[model samples]
Target: MNSPDIKPPGAEPAVKTHDNRRRWWTLLAVSAAQLLVVLDGTIVNIALPSAQTALGMSDASRQWAITAYALALGGLLLIGGRVSSALGHRRTFIIGLVGFAASSALGGAAVNPGMLFGARALQGVFAAALAPAGLSLLTTTFTEPRERGRAFSVFAAVGAAGSALGLVAGGLLTEYTSWRWCLYINVPIALFAVGGTALVPADRPIRGGGRLDVAGALLSAAGFGAVVYAFNEAEPLGWGSPKVLALLVGGVLLLAAFAAVEVRAPSPLLPMRVLSHRARAGALVSITLMFVAMFGFYLFMSYYTQTVLGYSPVQAGLTLIINALAALLGSTLIAGRLHGRVPPAMLILPGLIAAAAGMLILTRLTPQTTDVLPLYLVPALVLTGLGLGCVLPPTAGLATSDVHPYDIGAASAAYNASQQLGAALGTALLNTIATSAAASHLASARHATPTGASVHGYTTALTVGFGILLAAACVTAPLILKQQRS
Candidate 1:
């Protein structure tokens, strides 16, 4: 007689065959939505100068274009997650796509900076719903370990390379057409993603005992909003300014209150149990730290290629293709192939090491450096890309893996929150460091040329970023050890 634990051969084959047929379609749908959101985060960087010129906005106001999106997306993610669980993943995902498309169209038709900013913020609101719902769907849909690995490999690769791809697409559009096309382009992409959603499995919405935690949601949103505002203020007002100081303190206090509320709430917006797993917590933290370096790379590279190397926006965007290709290969081949064969840290640790080494290579830049591309920048970027590609897929998988079904949406949103906040913090902190370094060089030196000071500033800021990447590696190392011991 067959063992009680064994499934009938026919039964297993039927289930497996169905998943094989339907899984690829689901992946395509989710991936398209993800690309829409991730690409938007950096697409504007390339178009910012043109957008500012078109809208007659000052340098001081340019950051609002990015910050507004980050603030709304990051702050409201918890509510988005909870709402997705209450309504249903498939329904919320489609709604988000539609909303995002409408906002993109609005932004494309903007007559002023205020219009553009408002549109971008609305785009973030929809994305807050779309991103987590897509991730949670992937988490629940792929039950088999191997299939899950492959799904996440594609998802993470697209996510890792989306920002680089944005630079390329943004440049081509801005140089050849108009900056408005960058926003308009998302309409087609989102509409296409929405069309594909019919193939995804019909997921049941959470019901009964899943009441919204109104107080917890409010506290978290307000707290995160304040923190995001403080970081934006720090770019121009200095870190120690009273406005920045008050916001920082208030944000922290509110967040502390949020934690207290979560622990007591009957239906917590972020159920404490979702964060109880050590591996999941570690994965979330690692994702946050990695993006700190990754976003800084994107921000600095755009300026460096344009201002220092005298490359046009199109040329600068093309240069990033090398990095994107490396990342794509590493995610599919290295991380994808090793998914079930080895421990995740086995991939993540080496990836972090390679990324940190790449940053060290970048620290060699100077005003006298003429061949930045052929020699230093290309190889360094490739290394960073490979490392990130290897690291991101596995960590993302871990963040939502093995969670209770109802909590998956919240788990996915928390991961996204970590990434968005990391990007905001990295952009603000690194920009501040670069600007301060340049000013100090001018003040202290007897004969400081603008080129010398600028290059010095870029390198100094990157050096700090390098150290942060190393710190990230250190953070992951202990978690790996703990998992091994257990």
Candidate 2:
């Protein structure tokens, strides 16, 4: 029979004593680690062209660099989380940080496409290890509601700002320095984080009877990898293509099989109980849906600003800083302050509505609209950032709240994985929708120029994005409201 506390074999034992004074420093270390991971997600985008040119890679082959990172990191996230529980948080964190830094160094020094791709994938593996461990550390460290909210607010603000910061940093480095610096930049950050790890409380590894569910880990990782790869390929190859269809189908089948295995296994890579709570489940779903809008928005906005508005990479990056700043204020000042005082649903619902309205504002954009920055883009970006800021921090806290200590790592992994998969799905599905809309506009319109068709497609996609945000609100608002009432 399982004990109430269930110190399963892979679960780490609780620390005997915590250094209360050093907790804030620990948060800084974990936050820095998380910032590095999140920043890497978008930092490579601006540098991709330069990297490709340096490595002499074809356009078709170039995506492998990005895809490799996503697949490895996203797919292995659960395993990494589980491993964190098994190995202890500080150990996992340090190992992950070191490995990640080394991989970044390797990527920075790459002389060929293969070397860069390999290094990118390796970076992903270490990222998988780093993210959940950091989050779980934060979850375990800050248990008081007020302090937790404050902590998550800081973490969420950093996360919200990281992608935009990545754009600016990438642009600066690519233009003024070298693309290699983008990867090399991670090394110093990682080293600093490693040193910061010394302040963290030591965790004792859980040693007991349960064995690792190797099969469950394999199935889940492969399933997720295939799904991410399918979505990625869907952009280049039509959704109906055989390769895409097979991968999607196979991925689903593998995931289903993994579910069956988890039900019967003594120890699971992703314990079903971690997702059993209504709040946690709702949080995960909302996080996924939010990213669906966010990832698509970033991709299309980059295209619209650069292709239509004729912004330079640096200028394009600079414009996004508005969104980042807005997000920081909204998350840390607005949402963070209101966390315990207000019901989460109240904040999230209005935020979602505001975000939808913001996306709707984006629909007014066109090639004829010359004052794009002031008239349409800035307002929309600010609104979206505000909305997201309200949503992310609170929901992130909810994601791990009330979770079992044994399952904390898995819960964190699930949250991060949802964001990753959501981004991949958004990028693939929305891009496809927009491309098809453009093609149809070209074919059907009476006086359709390429520019007009493209803009029309972008607006059409933005409309869909608005609809998605509304749908997410519909799904999440009721769940949160119901929780509040109960």
Model 1 ranges with Cα > 4 A deviation: 1-15, 58-62
lDDT of 1 by residue, 1-486 (tens): 878989876999898778677777788989999999999998987788999999999887888888888888988998888888888988999999999999999999999999999999999999999999998888878878788888888988898889899999999999889999999999999999888887788898988645689998999898998898888888889898999999899999999999999999988999888777777877878888888887777778878888888888888888888888888888889998888788888888888888888888989988888778988898888998998899888888888887877788899999988888888788878888888999999889888988788888888888988888889889877876586568
Q: How many pairs of residues in model 2 come into backbone collision?
A: 0
State every prediction's TM-score relative to the real structure. Answer: 0.94, 0.94
Per residue, candidate 2 scores C-alpha lDDT tens digits across 1-486 of: 767996766445333234565678778999899889989999998999999999999998999989999999989999998988889878999999999999999999999999999999999999999999999889888887788888888898888889888988999999999999999999999999999998887886655517888999999999999999999999999799999999999999999999999999988888898877777777888889888888888878788878777889898888889988888888889889998888877777777888888899989877687777788998999998998888888888888888877888888999999999988998888888889999999999998888888898889888999999999888987777787688
Q: Give per-model CA RMSD.
A: 2.8, 5.7
lDDT agreement with native, every candidate: 0.87, 0.88
Score candidate 1 by TM-score against the native. Answer: 0.94
Model 2 regions more than 4 Å off: 1-18
Model 1 C-alpha lDDT versus the unseen true structure: 0.87
Q: Worst 10-residue stretch by lDDT in candidate 2? A: 10-19
